[model samples]
Target chain A: MNLNATLLGELIAFVVFVLFCMKYVWPPLNGAIEARQKKIEDGLAASDEAEKELERVRKEAAVELNEAKSQAAEIIEQAKKRAALIVDEETTRGQQEREKIIAQGHSEIDSERNRVKEELRTQVATLAVVGAEKILEREINQDAHSDIVDKLVAEL
Target chain B: MAAEEVTLSSHIQHHLTNAKMCSTDAGLAFNKACADSGFWTWHVDTLAWSIGLGLLFLWIFRSAAKKSTTGVPGKFQCFIEMIVEFVGDNVRDTYHGKSALIAPLALTIFVWVFLMNLMDLIPVDFLPAFAGFVGETAFGMDSHDVYMKIVPTTDINMTAALALGVFFLMIGYSIKMKGIGGFIAELTLHPFSTKNKIGMIFLIPFNLLLETIALVAKPFSLALRLFGNLYAGELIFILIGAVGLMQLPLHFIWAAFHILVIVLQAFVFMMLTIVYLSMASSDNH
Candidate 1:
């Protein structure tokens, strides 16, 4: 077929088509695609940031937990030490109290025994004097009376 | 005429010809088929067909463009939008940097070529035979001279035109993207020689010749590829239809098969256009 007209027609048509499509078709389509791509990239970036945040929080929590655990251990150790010191102090105080009580009891017993012995000796002397006075009145001589008293006292 | 006892070839022509002979226009060779009256007649030529098809597609796309939604698209909108997106994505993948023209140009090439290619799907005899009838009835010209080819891409002129347009675009874009000096430098120094002056001198002439051949070959390849596919398709359809009444079923089957060819050819043309544009736009050898 003679294609001179056809060729010219096709060229004109292609030029018109290229112009028309450039004006109307490409913008929206490319916009939509680029928008979708950007959205995906943003979503991925957000996810990465969230993951990093999560990691940071986990580390912080671990540190806090470790600090809390160490503090509790230290408190427990302090409590144990305090408890041992209190027990030792209480034991020493109890022993001192026991010794003071024993010393006071011994002192009281010694004082009571000394007082009783002194009282018994005084009573014996008084009884002998009374018996000698009664016997000397009956007998009327000084030398005889003295000798009788001494013998009576000795016999008692 | 002396009958020199000629021996007939043993092979017999098939019975299908008898059926076709029955449908032959008895007076077609002798008949002075006329052209039709009215605007439709002028529009019957290749140029008119191209313009008309372009306008029809534009109208359809305009309507689709008007109904384009911000929300979820309807089925038709989605279909149209898919084509648009596909074209855009293809441009992005193939053509790098900011080619404001190439992407849309590629889109136009794709749609126009596709529509032109679709003309092959119309029955071979439908338009021309109808035009012949109309010519005889209306314009009072010979129907034989009406000679309207509906499938524009099948025509060498149409394919070459398209190729030439692309060729011009390639040149224009190259010049616009790469300055005249840069363009010349590239042609001279490319595909060899980075630093050495000797290497540059040796490679420049060879590269220049290769580049020149490549530039010429681009349009040729584009034109021939589309023309070859479409013309072959048109030929096959004509051949199938020539088998006449007995082969109606076979013709129908071949027509169905031809639909695949039509779409495939369109796609191939579109892909090649993208590739060529990409090549033209690039700095790489």
Candidate 2:
């Protein structure tokens, strides 16, 4: 129990050990713990951001799908309308062309019939003139009787 | 005749004596030879065990501290970390001051003192008997002359040294936080102050006496409490050893109980030191 050099030795040892612990031990361990805490927090925050982004992208995709579906339907409707209008226009043009062709054939037929009738009348007039010459025993002059022949043909 | 005849009293006395070494007029001396040596004498057993245990504390802690990581810890790492965290939490709870030294100082005291106290659990005669055998055979010295008190905390020199260190720190912190004038005023003022200036003049001496005794008693109690606890534990073990084969049950019972004292005393020493330093740094008074 007597005071001695052992006390001095222990005192020196205690101070040295405390200083060693203070300098080397405390800070690094505390730093590692804090750094790990920050890392975990950052990881959690990033996961949250990813979840929000996923929700946003999902919403955008749904909207685009709806828009594209409507756009396709509108295009199909326009094409159907255009096809119907083209069919109507072609039908009207075909009907007008068929009527005009039938009219032209009738005009050509009338022209042909008139030409034949004129020939027949000329023949009949000639024959009538020959018979009259034979009956009266004298000839008829063509140049002086043209107006009478045209009137006789017209009457026939 | 057996060259070594052991008596009941001498057996206990030998277990209690430290292996002392000091300079004498004739030259170098040890143990019984250093009996008349004064303050300069060294208790080699106490110095050896205390420093050895202190080094052990540092070595283990240093390795763990060196390899510590933020990732998953190994078993050894976790064990050391638990101790560090336990002491750190106690310091944070008890110590209100901002000094970086308090926590580490607390850690050192708890671990170091506990390690030294752990020596008490060893069979009482084991190390000393072995040391005496080595002395008798190797160095050709009488077996009884070679003493080894394995537990350092049982030695007053060891406990007093630690308490005195805390004592110095307490004073230093008091002076640092409250200047010398303030420290002096704190000692010589209040607890007996009055509105009367003449009354204040009369009260300073009484106040100084009370405060000085109170201040010095802090370290004295700290040292003696640890010393008394461990010394009594060691003495009981020695007495139990004298009972020969029948000592087994008694030793186990006492050792089991002493374990609580070992840890509690170390904890008490650490907590008191933090509180004292906390008070020293505080100006609340």
Candidate 3:
């Protein structure tokens, strides 16, 4: 109920406590709060950067896959063209070999026919001479007729 | 019957008195031996408990600050940060002036004042009765002489001291914002004035008188508001205790309601101090 020197003591205590609080307590805690805010902001930014990087890699992979697929298609196309050309060349070479074999066979057959015809002609001539000799021997005595037959054979 | 009435009145008186110490012409004195006009009187109980509570607040905050991290906070750090942020937010909202002192000062007043007011919730007779028993047994002093008022905010001196501190800060801010000349002029000008030189000159005294009362009332209201609320609550607690065994329920109910008053008064004190400083810092005139 009365004013006394206790107020002075309390006043001193209040000022000292406030000064101490301002110096010690407030700054570090505020620093920690601000630091945490910065840390969270940085974390979010890094995550966003990583997400962008992932998207870029995914796009690159898709492009490379398309390139590889097109290259494979081109190789298959070249192989098909080479196989078709080889088949065409083989067919042409086979046609030429068949023609040459046919020509040789025809030439051999012609030669054989000519040799048989010549042999047959020779045999016919010999047979005709013999018959004429038999006739001459029976009809007119043999010597003069034989001479004629030999001459005929020579002519044939 | 008269003797019982006297005893009851004395019980109420005993709860109201502080454990006082003061200087005398011979040497030192306590309580009744101190003079009525003893300006040197010290309320030892109020001083001890209030300062002790203030230190406890500092120690806890310091430890919390030490353990605080930029990462996930533990429960203790979380609770401490909540209170600090609460005061910081209030200061930021109420105080437009850019000074480092306001937030921490607000925190100090709020926590320190709240702690002092919290002492009212302790059973009214518990500490004083223990103090009396100890005094009678340990010291050879009469138990009647042991007056221990534990709730510091209930004492006018303690609240007045806090309010006076805020009052000084207000004046300092007003002076700093509007220099010495501007401060004096501000006190003695406007709120009423005239373009006429003679009329303005006549208005100066009236303005000074009105503004001075307004300025002085800040601290006066601040001190009495907290002291009156706590003192009334304490007196009622004391009165209820006189109801014998039934005091427990009534005491609980009153204390439950008083908790609101205790917290609200501390908040109001802090808010008013910030608002006053903000007003001082701004040169609206």
Best by TM-score: 3
Model 3 in CAPRI terms: which quality? medium
Runs in model 2 lying further than 4 Å from the true structure: A41-156, B1-4
Candidate 2: Cα lDDT at B34: 88
Where does the lowest 10-residue lDDT sum fall in candidate 3 chain A? A133-142
- The number of the candidate with the highest DockQ is 3
lDDT of each: 0.69, 0.89, 0.89
Residue range B258-280, candidate 1, lDDT tens digits: 78887777677777777877776
Colliding residue pairs in candidate 2: none
Per-model i-RMS: 5.2, 1.4, 0.9
Per-model TM-score of chain A alone? Answer: 0.49, 0.50, 0.46
- The DockQ assigned to candidate 3 is 0.55
TM-score of 1: 0.61
TM per candidate comes to 0.61, 0.77, 0.79
Candidate 2 lDDT tens digits, A26-130 = 666555656766888998999999999999999999999999999999999999999999999999999999999999999999999999998988888887766
- Give lDDT tens digits, candidate 2, residues B32-150: 88888888889898989888998898889888888888778789888988888888889989887687899889999999999999999999989999999999899999888899999
Pull out the clashing pairs in model 1.
B33-B141, B33-B142, B33-B143, B34-B135, B34-B141, B35-B141
What order do candidates take by DockQ, descending?
A: 3, 2, 1
Sequence-dependent TM-score of model 3 = 0.79
